[model samples]
Target: MKKGFKYVFMTLLVVALMLGSFLLGNKMAITTGDKVILNKSDFNIYSKTNQMKAVIDKYFLFDVDERKLEDGVYKGLFKGLNDPYSEYLTKEEFDSFKQSTSGEYKGIGIFITVTEDNLIQVVSPIKDSPAFKAGIKPDDIIYSVNGKVYPGDKLNEATAIMKGKDGDEVKLVIKRKNSTGAYDSIDMDLKVEKIKLLTVESKVIDDLGYLHISQFGEHTYKEFTENYEELKSQNVKGIIIDLRNNPGGLKDSCVKIADYLLPEGPIVKTVDKNKKEEVDMSDAKEENIPMVVLINGGSASASEILSGAIKDYKKATIVGENSYGKGIVQTIAPAKSFGIDDNGAIKLTVQEYFTPKDNKIHEIGVKPDIEVKLPDDIINFGPDFIDTDTQLQKAIEILK
Candidate 1:
């Protein structure tokens, strides 16, 4: 789900697009972490591939594009790993991925994520956007785009399919689950248009400051800092950081905000395949303000980084259910770097990141110091519905 701003986990959670070209067959150089490793593989995969290709070239009756054939093999490299996060992207999909971090783009404004069952599900529709006006709601499964079914693993393709000329219409088939657990299929046609991302929203309730980070984007740190100044101007006593339903975005943005909040200490650490560790530390003087971080199943990757760091330093009280627990990092490189063309790209799982306390948060999420659970039906609430947000009320109570 990514290709921009260092390490991105959510792939923008948007309809933004990034385009590039792809080429193939140079198997020597591979990008790992920040380095390109050049060495012959211990396995004779090239030989096996050539053998299979020879048969296809000699015996297959139907004509096949040799480039596409090789591209399929290249894609199989990542797919064979069987890791859900790592993937191969065509030029169109890669372009869509790069556009995700820009904070604005053209599309049918909708935020989507992968369900636990690996189905593409909508998180929410952007206010006043085509999807929103069409009555699309949170938790609705995106069954198909343009009449073609796209599974969770192929979400990048689905997102790419949503992009087109301004005013272009995109057909959507959604599967919405009803109260009785029965799913009702609905079809809607929405037009693609330019939309800006609002990553952070803030509020002041008497002495308490409330900051809701929908997701980390390229400009989120700037937005957060601006809001923090406003909260300070209001003479806020404490701050509540809400990371519920935040899938996560740019790692650099997350690190910047964490650095802004914490003191001269390690914010997070990353371990590469060789077990080499790098620590990201903050240089700012510590702020002694009281803090409570709120997280739920949707809090992941970069979200986990910020919450875990705050908790590690004992700088905040963590509340709500366990986070989404994505501790690994993924990096994408243009396929041409490995000697491929047609704007092809490869996103591979490069490293695992740990909290400041050296705690692992991959499958095991960051646990709350004080755990609270919201009813399933009420998990998604707007700012206007503060009374129904028990986790937020609990945070406010702690701050008070």
Candidate 2:
């Protein structure tokens, strides 16, 4: 009887263990099995919490809550990424980002970046804005915002705190590198204001037509065309196309600007990972004007493409610090995949861009023919400030 009882207990235990394994496996299959890739050999995504999530939702909670699951999963996933750039922006935050890029967002002007140490730092301040007038400088490490301590290694929380209704005050505790101590809490009253984008600014300085292209916004082509016509009307001796701090936008604008500058030849070519090619639009019949391009580290993407093409074609003299080296072109993919989020949005580096002369402008930046550093004291000018504009000055000297 004792032996029979022991045997029965062992059998029951074995049956219970098998049932538990089946339930766990089935839960994972229902929740996260869909994320598994078929062809990829090296990439694998494993989530043990999905099984726990399934158990809680089905047996314990009995109420479906996607918000809880989404937040839980997102926090879990992003924390592991360890890349400040790699983050999960809620729909609202994502909308804000899109609006900011589209020149539709309202806020006191400031550009920001996350340093390697996970501290948010000011990259630059827009001139005539609250931040600029308040004396915020680049490389100022933000310690706290609005009396709230920074959340554990999360920038999203800090961003949410910084943004609010117009007329709201954001208190910032900042630490400057060369300073002896951190700044006492300073209040920056953010005024909600629409960004008025001016793509082109032209003036004749000493018989030389200076056209500054601030950005490649939506109406860039129209502005550039009108400015070019106006400059021609002025009969300027020469042109200095200033593209400093132009982080580039619409490819069409760059091409249009190149069309106005280049006499002919391919402006740029894009080579895909598969080695396929597409030549960027350019014009050969345009007049080869006596022009100089001014670029710096802030000039990137389309700017790099245009400058590289002009230099390779020997169409214009590139004068400034090295141009930002961004050779990869990203393409939006259609159809949904497991790793991708909504909007069916996937931005994979589809190709590498090359100059008409087949020169690669990847990690290696475009070297200037005449290099001149902008003055550090010129910080007072902010984004609109161009004190000495050493590169522009050099361009003028060359034109003379």
Candidate 3:
């Protein structure tokens, strides 16, 4: 891969790694996005670390593992950014991250994000996957993994524990909201399996097409196009796009799908720290049918891109609550370019994205045209839950 690699619109969760040589700390010159350059001599701050290392080497009670210490320095480097989305990936984590974009992996099959308070929140479980079948729902909190508590900062470590050989059981302690607005702890022993990515799940609800997009993976565009075409062939007159609890994924996948539904215009725009701007546009061709997009707190990044575009152009009526409001973008740059490659890469926050109308999505989410919250009675998104789905019923009411 080249220096500036893929522009990903998703959060690839991970942290912690074994240490290696600190070739990067001493003589290497590193460049920052904001035109800051750090060379060896300018890095006298390392003297403090060295002083601590000397003290630990002399008086520490137990043997110090240089491997883990080195890894800590690497992680600490990125953690200095204070941006939760930006992280340094180890070789193993990087490999797994690549596999996740490909839409398949050996894990319990759930998308997750770490909160500001260092809690791990489940965005959604992949439909039909182990976690999905186990009834793990959105907004669920993961307290511990395999009896070990991993703070939000150690998300990568927790995920590492979750993924493994098929049929291997891993225990997860979850905190779920219950009746009377209380939280309940639940223990689950989930089996690791090879989860095949099926991002788009579609079926006809009378004359309307209901398509729930879990995430925008690499194959998402192709799958979305094929599924929409199938719905068209079946004479479905309207559409309901479900993005609830959908953790966003690839930018390109979302762009292509946006192009299919929208008329010629800018889908989304991004500007980096250098004030450099790039706008993704759609063609004149468009789908003319009535459309309703469903979004909630979990609908983020590229999902906001599509829904924002649809809202900007009045292409679709938005339903449900406000979105997750993650307007910033991240990229996986080749670590080799920085002379720090051990088959690993760095995911850095490169740019802040805007909706087509130039509205910022960073901390403020997109508002729905008609707001309808999910009813308290509706729990799982099972077949029987649709009638009680107030947001969905509102969408149906709009189309009718």
How do these models rank on lDDT, best leading? 3, 1, 2
Candidate 3 C-alpha lDDT tens digits along 1-400: 1122111101110100111112354464434444324444444445455556668778999977776776676788888777888988878888898899898899998989877787889877887889988878778999999999888889998998899888889999999888768899999999999999889989888799889898999999998989999999999889999988788889989999999999998999999999999999999999998999999877888899989899999999999999988898999865886796455678999999998999999889899999888766455562346767888888888898
Query: Which prediction has the highest lDDT against the true structure?
Result: 3
Each model's lDDT comes to 0.79, 0.64, 0.82
lDDT of 1 by residue, 230-307 (tens): 998898999888887677788999999999999889999999999999899999676677999998876888999999
Please list all clashing residue pairs in model 3, or write none if there are none. Answer: 14-156, 15-156, 19-67
1 or 3, which is superior by lDDT? 3
lDDT for 237 in candidate 3 is 84
Global CA lDDT computed for model 2: 0.64
As for lDDT, the candidate ahead, 1 or 2, is 1
lDDT of 1 at 133: 77
Please write out the lDDT profile of model 2 over residues 187-293, one tens digit for every residue. 44455454555767777776888877766767777887798778888888788887766666667778877877676568888887687898876656675558888
